[model samples]
Target: MKPLDPRLLRYARGTRVYLAATVALGVVLAALIVAQATLLAHGITAVFLDGADVRTLTPTLIALATVVAGRAAVAWAQETVAVRSSAAVKSELRGRLLAHLVAVGPARGGDTGAVTTLITRGLDALDAYFARYLPQLVLAALVPAVVLARLLPADLTATMTIALTLPLIPIFMALVGLHTEAANHRQFRLLSRLSHHFLDVVAGLTTLKVFGRAGAQAATIRRISAEQRRLTMRTLRVAFLSSLVLELLATLSVALVAVGIGLRLVSGHLDLTTALLVLILAPEAYLPLRQVGAHYHASAEGLAAAEEAFAILETPVPARGAAPAPAGTIVFDDVVVRYRDRDALHLSATVEPGEIMALTGPSGCGKSTALDVLLGFVTPDHGRVTVGGVDLASVDPAAWRSTIAWVPQRPYLFAGSIRDNIALGRTPMHLPEPPTAFAHCFTGTVPDAPRPDVAAAARLAGAAGFIAGLPDGYDAALGDDGAGLSAGQRQRIALARAFLRDAPIVLLDEPTANLDTETAADVMAAIRRLAHGRTVIIAAHRPELIALADRIVDLAPQPVGAR
Candidate 1:
């Protein structure tokens, strides 16, 4: 990305304000720099050339001090604003990225480790872009013009010399930047791969140990880590080289301007004050440009990640309508879902309100795809789904989702108290007890307390018994994904959330697939109770769950060549 990519302004809100403020501060800073230079030159000339005493130069001394202070204040403010803006931009980008990922669903291929790194470490790289690169970019444009305007009236020769040579810095910067950007891109890709590989190995460490391959995997990790280190060193080398080139060009340009001013001073054609001012201000003109080059190298990785994030955000989402979904029967008429060249599901079915409907099929028969359709996560390629004669496509997705509750095969438990987990979707509340050490593992705020109706929902889901037996009842904190809880306990917590949601439609995807027999029986009982007076759809192969369905819809696997 360039110093200021248009996409940042387009995708992140409030960036325009930051840019405008930076420009305004740059202008103020330029004025202070010029004033300080003029005062310093005048004070030195008055004392040395005119033989003026301290009493005579006191006002000049005070004015110079004020100008210096003003410059410092402006620099501090610019830095403060840039830091805040970087934070805001990252927050906004992360929010949009997460929302887009959720909308796209997990069926859409994405590496978990890459996405995690992008939102965390990748976005953190933007700090250099906003704090250093963008502020200097503004100064690079404004300070030079302001300094040139001041110098032209004082000495046209010195002004022209600076104008002619200043372009060399940018020329060298651009050439070096081409190489730096490529190296940074490669480094970012390697970091993402390293994160993915390490996470995969860690997650499967138990399996690897069981198969006696953990040592081999450790060697593989070491190799990946070494490669990452090599790439990082390469990127750093390019960055340092670019900075060196920028510094050399800037120093050479300032030296040329200073030589011109010095020769004119010796010839008695230039006044001492003007020559001194020109010499001092000439270097200031090139400083911002050199700084811009330095910051660009630091921020390149963030720019690459931002580019990827923009691509994800720009992917088209299924169009949703404004109409609300009706609380009635849902009909799936010849619905078909295709992935690549294969049809995952091709079937027709109806699920009426207050009925338990079961979808049974072998693995890969699109049982989950059917549930996805109901959840509005997938759009069918052919046929349609309608509720009370209104097309599902025409109903607003958010509105439709608001009327349903869903439980996946593996229910995710956030790090929080038992009560907070049960009241996940409700109003935020203070936790009755402080979170445990394990709560620090997950991202996001854990409610300090639980919602008022958490106990009722827990009772309805048969979770109140175990929860009450805990030391702190609903306030007892659980680890990441409820690590401390039994599978049955976790499922009950999910059921409590569903009961609390009280939506008319309930969808479950193999809720009992991983539970022990006794636990599964308990979950089944909770499911039966929760399905009362609601439209329940279960995608399951287990006879216990299928037997409870008011009607069963068995799906057959598609033929090998079927479209």
Candidate 2:
């Protein structure tokens, strides 16, 4: 198991002040309870039983009620602060994780697990750490020490006994905690596997139905579910056992303190009020420790998740070489990109300032990888890629990427208007503020603005007519990844986005692969229109696209070859 990472401290950065405030509130609550217990014990012995005076009992009752209310109020405040902190941390981690995943992409984070796991189960695991485990950890350290100091002068032996037992919580916690990392890792795997299989099953449900094998797939899913059930149950059993052990330890320690205090009272070593206070407040101190111990497993799981999350966040991406002074040509200098356990392919090309160069290759012929290198998505194992005469390796990726626009093989359509998706591709941070039905930004609006240019790009994509027939036109809200539209419709929208950007250099990858003929033709025409006087590199197999290329650099995978 890995040592407890100090990086967990980073999650609490935005919440540091609140964490202190929350813990302080918790201490106030603990103190209130302790004070109330002390007052009540004194009242019972000094006045109620002795019947010396009813006057003194009034102060004790008031003090007890006041402390009880203070404890309740502070407890609520602590909960509110703790939840707010957890929310802030969760928000930051999720956004950062998404951005990193988008930057690294499936081509990089491949075979690890479903992306759903990264966003869903993986992130969900951290909830306990932030929400419960972390707060308890703070309380265990702060509350116990403070509570002990108060009890020390009152009953030295009992306070010391409880104080000494505090170390056992973390010690045994560490022991059992060691084994949990592996168990959590296994659980994470099962969780991801479960999600991956679910996504695959959902995505392929149509195919399965077409082939009449949905039943078989369902059976397979059931089998996976059964395995996941077994894994989950196994984890729970371990968690239950650990909880039992911690409970047992805390129970025995507190019980021993009570017995000793009882004996001391009988022998005249302790007074009645002191003994009652010890009995009442002893469990108060022991409670948080056991709760901390119980939640140790939850924290351990979260820590394991944080490890994986950090791995993705902290990973260094392939360099986007030295930034050219301004937008310059993409130069491939005898670049040889090799995949491990696969044949290597070499590429050499210079996409000049304003001429379209289409790269054609068979599937898995390093076409996408080649584009990835130019886009600085992948760095070549050998040779150099330069833009504007400076090597890409030395360039700032953001600045270099800022100079280009890409229409990937499968462009993503977000859960918003057509305008929002296009804004993502805009250059110079300039969004076209056209007087259309929608302003191309979130806050901007163009009433009844004609999206004909948007429509034109769609027309060229063979998607114009179908969209024209839609009730909302471009104003329709598409589901994430364009769930509402056909796959061809999604591609057309993407091509329209590329057209809308009108970038100096366009790097596209088979933007019309799965579209029907008419749609593909319009999409191709849109590409031609989009490519006029721009450096365009399309990793495409279509004959129509091949005809548009001034020169075709074939990246055909071979035992050995030169293009």
Name the best candidate (by lDDT): 1
Pairs that collide in candidate 1 are 430-448, 430-449, 431-448, 431-449
Shift in Å, residue 64, candidate 1: 1.9
> 218-330 in candidate 2: lDDT tens per residue?
89889888987887777778888888888888888888898999889899999888888878887778777678767767766667667777777777765444544356777
For residue 503, give model 2's deviation from the true position in Å: 2.2
Q: Write the residue-wise lDDT of candidate 1 on 178-291 in tens digits.
A: 888888888888888989988888766756897999999899989988998998998899888778878888888888887777888899999999999998899899998888
Q: What are the lDDT scores of the predictions, listed in order?
A: 0.83, 0.70
The lDDT of model 2 is 0.70
TM-score between model 2 and native: 0.83
Worst 10 residues of 1 by lDDT: 428-437
